[model samples]
Target: MNAASPASPLLEVRGLRMHFPVSEGLLGRKVGDVKAVDGIDFTVRRGETLGLVGESGCGKTTTGRCVLRLEKPTAGQIIFDGVDIASLGGKQLQALRQRIQVIFQDPYSSLNPRMTIGQIIAEPMFVHGIEPNATKRMERVHELLTICGLNAGFADRYPHEMSGGQRQRVGIARALAMNPEFIVCDEPVSALDVSIQAQVVNLLEDLREKFGLTYLFIAHDLSVVRHLCQRVAVMYLGHIVEMADSDTLFDNPQHPYTRALLAAVPVPDPDVEQGREFRPVKGEVPSPMNPPSGCVFHPRCPMAVDRCSKEAPQPREIAPGHMVACSEVKITG
Candidate 1:
């Protein structure tokens, strides 16, 4: 499944957009569109984790869904392993699924309460015609459970019989059953306790190494993103405002939104924390349905200039791999 080389990234998304049409009346005449994801682009290199981070409503989840083909895009290409999957259909798309999978955010709601854990994990294998025999599928299920750090005996139990962390692990086991090359980890650790969160993050890192899996890790937790991702992309109102290696992005955030977000990450040092003057971004996140013209983030950006409200800034590579979409920040490559 790892059919990628240095010549190309495992996942390359260009101008991807997902807009939910707004309608009026029972006839459903389209009046407007909710621009959940609007013209965003990035690439997830093979064996690397690219974090898609933003506030809750900034369309990071929608972008992940579009990449997985759970939601079809309005425009643009979702190229996976040298093929554009956004346009695939029928058997072509079905076959392509073997190389891609998703681990959802809510473990409880994602799993079926009616099905036993063994059946749940084995369903994907059976659907994809992986393990044909019942006994073999069960064995594979048990093995997957073990790989996800769950006991083999737990496979016989229902999702309700497990805790939040266990259920999330089961979800991971399900995704892994496909031997996927890329997995969209949509806030996989967000629902767990702080201690459990660390365990899950570590498990994902281990699996990535073990499988050479690529990830589009979507989350709002900057700390968690810093912990797990190699590269990070910051999104605001459906646009990637800035992107860089995790260390570079955290150490030297170039966008106003990015700086505001880092300012919010709590510091453990009481002396530093007490003395720090954090200025949270001003104004509420504007409605995506009626987003402001020019720069979408200008309404909340403290350093916004008159030009920021009049023209959108194009994304520029400020330094090697570091890209920022802002006109105000002056820098030299």
Candidate 2:
């Protein structure tokens, strides 16, 4: 679908679906499709972080990759800066890619250890034809290194020579080198030490403020999302169960799954946090290849009613900017 205006959403994902074929035989015969990101919709405002939170295999990462056009979606549209990129051809996609970037999770594996930090950061500039002068590239690379809190001299060192935090900083520098307006941060700090995670996240926050970057921060850690994202979208079995401003979702979660997720967040207060009143999400997440009928989460929802097992709830706006898709959802938080 071609977007109607050149002034439309900076990033608008509607009914995005990415289903991977599942093969069961030793010969790898196709048996089913893993309904990863199924019919999910959300928007990223020009300069805010929209945290995509969910359990493992809930397709948060798949959604991010689809937005980046790294993986082609099975359905729906990805409208970015007034262009629907979902159906863009390879040549067209390449041209539009310069404005979007990604900061991957594992800094160690994300960067080529064989390459020097300066080269890693300079490569983006070279690829985009932003700064072809070797001297200018060097100058820009050093400047970015400084901004990411690494010394200019450290640019000659390979990724393996630096700590996880430092490698992540290099990754951030590479992402910023192209002056991208939108970024998909796929669990950027999940693999780092807790102390290092803070530094990387803080750097990302500062960069966002300084460069006016929009981010789709996908992570399983809700606490990190609460701190970084302006709004939060919770996914379950390839569908968004709830979405609201960060504070609203954390303080007064509506859907049963969301409430369970928040309750599971470890609070510092051991006494109150350990109480029996809090309920851990029950049962295992259903297999995506064989998801339950009606509500995908009905089997595990404590408040699931008879209707929940037979009919899927439509996502509806309960508050000004909050939407949830659970019929038995009650906001008691």
RMSD of each: 1.4, 2.7
In model 2, what lDDT does residue 82 have?
Answer: 71
**What TM-score would each prediction reach against the true structure?**
0.97, 0.94
Across 179-284, the per-residue lDDT of candidate 1 in tens digits comes to 9989999999999999899999999999999988999999999999998999999999899999999999999999989999999888879999999997777778
TM-score: model 2 vs. ground truth: 0.94
Per-residue CA lDDT of model 2 for 48-155, tens digit only, reads: 899999999889999999998999999999988777999887778877778899999999899997899999999978987889899989999999999999999998
What C-alpha lDDT, on a 0 to 100 scale, does residue 54 get in candidate 2? 95
The residue-level lDDT of candidate 2 at 275 comes to 77
Collision pairs in model 1: none
